[model samples]
Target: MASTTSRHQVQDAQKLYDDRAAHYDDSWHPLFAHHMVQLADLKPGDHVLDLASGTGLVTFAASMAVGQTGSVTGVDISSGMLQQARSRLENHDLENVEFHQHSITDLDTLSVLRGKEFDAIMCASVLVLLQNPGQAIKAWAVYLKAGGKFITDVTHPASQISLITFERVGRGLNRPLPFYRVPFQKPEDLQLLMEQAGLRDNHIVSLSQLEAANAGEGIMAYMTDPAHPRLDKLYTIEDADDVFDKHIDHWAAELLSRPEIKNEARKIFKEEWARLANEEGKIEEMDCVFVGIGTKVG
Candidate 1:
C-alpha cells in the first residue's frame, strides 16, 4: 500500500469542525477537555484568552473558573465556529465571555490587545493546524502579561502510531502512516519556540483522563463522530492504515451505530485483532498524551 499522508494534510480541519458545530460537543468536547484546566488557575479577576477557541468549550470552562469578576476572550479563524460559541454564551447569558473571529497568527490582533495582556493564554487543538507555530506562540507571549500562564494540549503522536497498526491487503501489516509521528511542532519543539518567544517557567502540566472510557459524557460526544474516515479516492490502503494509525479509536468507534451494534462490531474487530495479535503477534493499543504549561517572561 502506498502512503497517502502527504495528500491528507490538505484537508482543512477548521472547516471540518465548522461543519460539525452542532455535534462538536458530542464529538470533541470530551476528548478536548481532558487536558484543558491549566488555564483555570486564572485569578478571580484575571483576564484570559482562548486562542483558536473552537466552539467555546475552553472559554466557557475558563469563564466558569475565572469567576464573575474575571473575563474571557475566545478567538478563532472560523466565523462559523465563533457563531456557535456566541450562541452558546447567549443561551447561558454569560456576559463575561466574548468572541472574536480572528487568526491566531495575526500580529496586529496582538497589538489590539495592547497593554491588555492576559493572566493566561491558551491555544489547544489549534496548534496542529498552524503553518507557523513559533510565531503564533510568540504572539501569545506578546499578548500575555509577565508571569502569565500559557497552556496547550498536544496529542502524543507516538501513542497514535502504536494504537492503530495498519495493514495493507498486499503489504501485510504494521505499515502505519508516517504522519502519525509527525507533529506540526512537538512538545520539545514547542518548548523551544516558547523559550525563544519569551515564555518561561515551562513544565509538563497534569495528565488529563488518558483513555476515553475515563472521559465524561460531554467530551465523549466530541469524539463520537459516527462517520467513517471516507477512505475513498484520496485515501489509499496505506493511507487507511495511517488514518487508523492516527485516529483509530475515534474512527473505529465511528464504524458502529447503537450500543448493540458497537458490541457486535467490537466483537468482530476484537476477534480479528486477536488473530493479528496471536498468529501474527502484531496488535496495536491506545495511549495517552499530555498538556504543557508555562509563563510568559519577557
Candidate 2:
C-alpha cells in the first residue's frame, strides 16, 4: 500500500510463502509461535487477531490458550498457506479458530474487521517483511480495544544464514536483489518502534538458541533454481534455461555478459556458503528473536 514497489514486494512475498507452505512446519518456526503465545498469556473468552498467520501457527496456539470461550481469527495473504492451515484445522475440532485470506495492511478496509475490536493482536516472524512496519502497527492498533496489547517480534540481524548470505552476495555484486528488511539490530530498536507507533509500556523479551542448518543446499537452490519464486521480482520464469542471462534482470545480463565475472561471482557465492558449514557439513544457525509487547493507548 505504500508504493508500487511495495505492492510488488508483497505479491512476490506471498508467492514465496505459498511455495513454502507445504513444508513450513517442518522447521522450528512453530516453536517460536508457541513461545510468543506463552508470552501473550491470553485469558479465556478473549478474542485474538493474528496477522500474517501462515499455516495457523499462532492462531492454533492462541486458540488453545484462550479456550472454548474465546475465538481466534488468522489472516494471511497466501491462499496456499491458508489451505494448509484449513486442512490442519480439519484434523482438530477447533470451532474457535478460523482463518481469512487478506493482506494485513488492508485489514481496516475489510467489512468484517472494520468495526470489530480484539483483545490482543499477534504477528510473529513477520514484522521485518513489511514495507512500512510502523504504519502497519499504527493501523493495527486501531482494532485493539483500549488497554489491549499488540505482540510481535524481530529476529536478530544475523538470524537467517541463507538470507543474510543472499543479501551479502547481492551487495558484493552490486546487483539489485529483492530481500526482506532486517530492521531491528537490538532490543531498543524494537522498543523505539513500538513507542513511535503510539504503543505504551513496552515489554521486550529475548529468545535464542543454536541449531544446525543446511545452509549450503539452501543457498545453492536460490542461486540455481530458475523457477524459484524468491527470484520472481528479478526474473521472468517461463521454463527458461538455467543460464542467468536468459531470464534474469538486464543487470544480471550485463554482469553475465562477461563470462569470467559470472564464473567468479558464482564461485564466490558457493564458496561463501561452503565456508559457513561446520565439521558436520551444517551451519550453526543462531535462532534469536526479540518479542515486543505494548498496550494500546486510550
Best by TM-score: 2
Residue-level lDDT of model 1, residues 1-298, one tens digit each, is 2222232222354555667777777763544553375334667888888887888888888887888899998878676677888888878967788887766767474444657778888877656555456776777787788878998755544333323332111012222222222432245755676778877887553232333454455433223211211111222222333443344445322323234343443344344444444233543332334466888765
Clashes of 1: 8
lDDT of each: 0.57, 0.71
Mark the regions of model 1 whose C-alpha exceeds 4 Å error after superposition. 1-13, 38-40, 107-112, 162-181, 184-187, 206-285
Instruction: Give each model a TM-score.
Output: 0.65, 0.72
Q: What is the C-alpha RMSD of each candidate to the true structure, in Å?
A: 10.5, 10.2
Candidate 1, RMSD to the unseen true structure = 10.5
lDDT of 2 at 211: 30
List, in order, the clash count of every candidate structure. 8, 0
Name the candidate that leads on lDDT: 2
Q: How accurate is candidate 2 locally (lDDT)?
A: 0.71
Q: Which stretches of candidate 2 lie over 4 Å from their true place?
A: 1-7, 168-178, 209-285
